[model samples]
Target: MWPAVGLTRSLYLKELYVARSRWRSGVGTVLMRTLFEVAAKHECSRVEWTTDANNPGAQRFYADLAFQQLPSKLFFRADATAIEHGLG
Candidate 1:
C-alpha cells in the first residue's frame, strides 16, 4: 500500500499468478475478490496493477473483472544487481 493524493491510500499489486493447474477454476476471481476485501478493510482507495501486454488471456481476465487500463502510465523497474552498480 502507498500514500495517495488524498487521505486515502492505494494498494499496488505487484503480481498475482495462479498455477497452471488452477487455470479456469475460478481461483483467480476468488483471489482478486479477497484482495479487494483486504484492501477495503485497510481503507485503501484503489487497487492498481499491471499485466503483461503479450498475455492476452491475463489481460482479458482483468478486463472481465472491470479493471481499467492506465495507458498513460509506464511501469519501471531497477534490477537489484544494476541498482548497486549504477548503469554504465
Candidate 2:
C-alpha cells in the first residue's frame, strides 16, 4: 500500500482481487474515484504510476482514469549477481 502524505501529492490504487462476484459490485470504479478525490484534496497537480508493459488491462484502467504515457524509458542495472558468491 502507498502511504498518503498529508496536504502533498500521492497516488495509488486500492488493490482488487480477480473474483467474479467482486467485479460485479463495481468496487474498482469506486476505489479509483476515491483515490482521485484524495489526491485532488491535497492539491496534487498530477498522479502517476506504472504498469507492466504487457498488462493491457492495467493500461486500459489507467487510461480510463485520464493518465497519459510519459515520454521516458526506465532502465535497470545491477553490479552484483549473487551476494553469497561475491560475484557481480
Candidate 3:
C-alpha cells in the first residue's frame, strides 16, 4: 500500500483475502490485527480499503471489525486507445 497524503493520511490496505476453507476461523481477524499493528508501528493514523459494492460478505466482514463505510465514487479510465494519442 502507498503512503498516501490528504484526508485520512494513513496506510492503505489495497487487498486482503482468506481462503474459503479458512472463513470464520479468525484468520482474517488475526491478519487485520497484525496489519493494524504494522500501521501503528509506521505511525499511520488508520487503514483504508475498498470492496465491490455487490460484495455483502466483505462489507459484513469489515463492519464486524468496526470499519466504517464511506460514501465515495470510484472512477476508472480505460483508455488504451487514448494512450496512443497521449491522452491517457
Candidate 4:
C-alpha cells in the first residue's frame, strides 16, 4: 500500500508470500531486495508491514531484513451488515 503523507510518499508492504515449495530458495530475499530498490526509486522514507504475532518465521524474516518491529494491535469491527456491504 502506497500512501501520501503530507509531502512524503510511503510504502507499505501489506503482504509477501512465497509458495511453500520455494521457501529457503532465496526467492524471498531477492523479492525483498527488489522491493527496497523500488522503494528507493520512489523515494519512500519508510516501508511498513505487519505479520501475525504467532508467525515467528515471518518475524525473523523481517528482522533479518532490518525492519524494526513496533508494538501494535490489529483491530476489526465488522458486523454482519458491514460484511454484506463489503466494508468488513
Alpha carbon lDDT of each predicted model: 0.89, 0.63, 0.82, 0.82
lDDT of 2 by residue, 1-88 (tens): 2344454556644354446567535676787777678778876755655667797776776677677767694734455655546744
Better of 1 and 4 by TM-score: 1
List the candidate 1 regions with Cα displacement exceeding 4 Å. Answer: none
RMSD to the hidden true structure, all candidates: 1.8, 5.5, 3.1, 3.3
lDDT of 3 by residue, 17-74 (tens): 8999999999999999999899888877667778888999999999999888987746
Candidate scoring better on TM-score of 1 and 2: 1
Candidate closest to the true structure, highest TM-score: 1
- Preferred candidate (lDDT higher): 2 or 3: 3
Each model's total of backbone clashes? 0, 0, 0, 0
Q: In candidate 3, list every pair of residues with a backbone clash.
A: none
Clashes of 3: 0
Native-to-model Cα distance after best TM-score fit, residue 20 in candidate 3, in Å: 0.3
**Displacement of the residue 2 alpha carbon in candidate 4, Å:** 6.4
What TM-score would candidate 1 get against the native?
0.87
What lDDT tens digits, residue by residue, belong to model 4 across residues 1-88?
4456666778878789999999888899999999889989989987767888799998888888787787674645688987889942
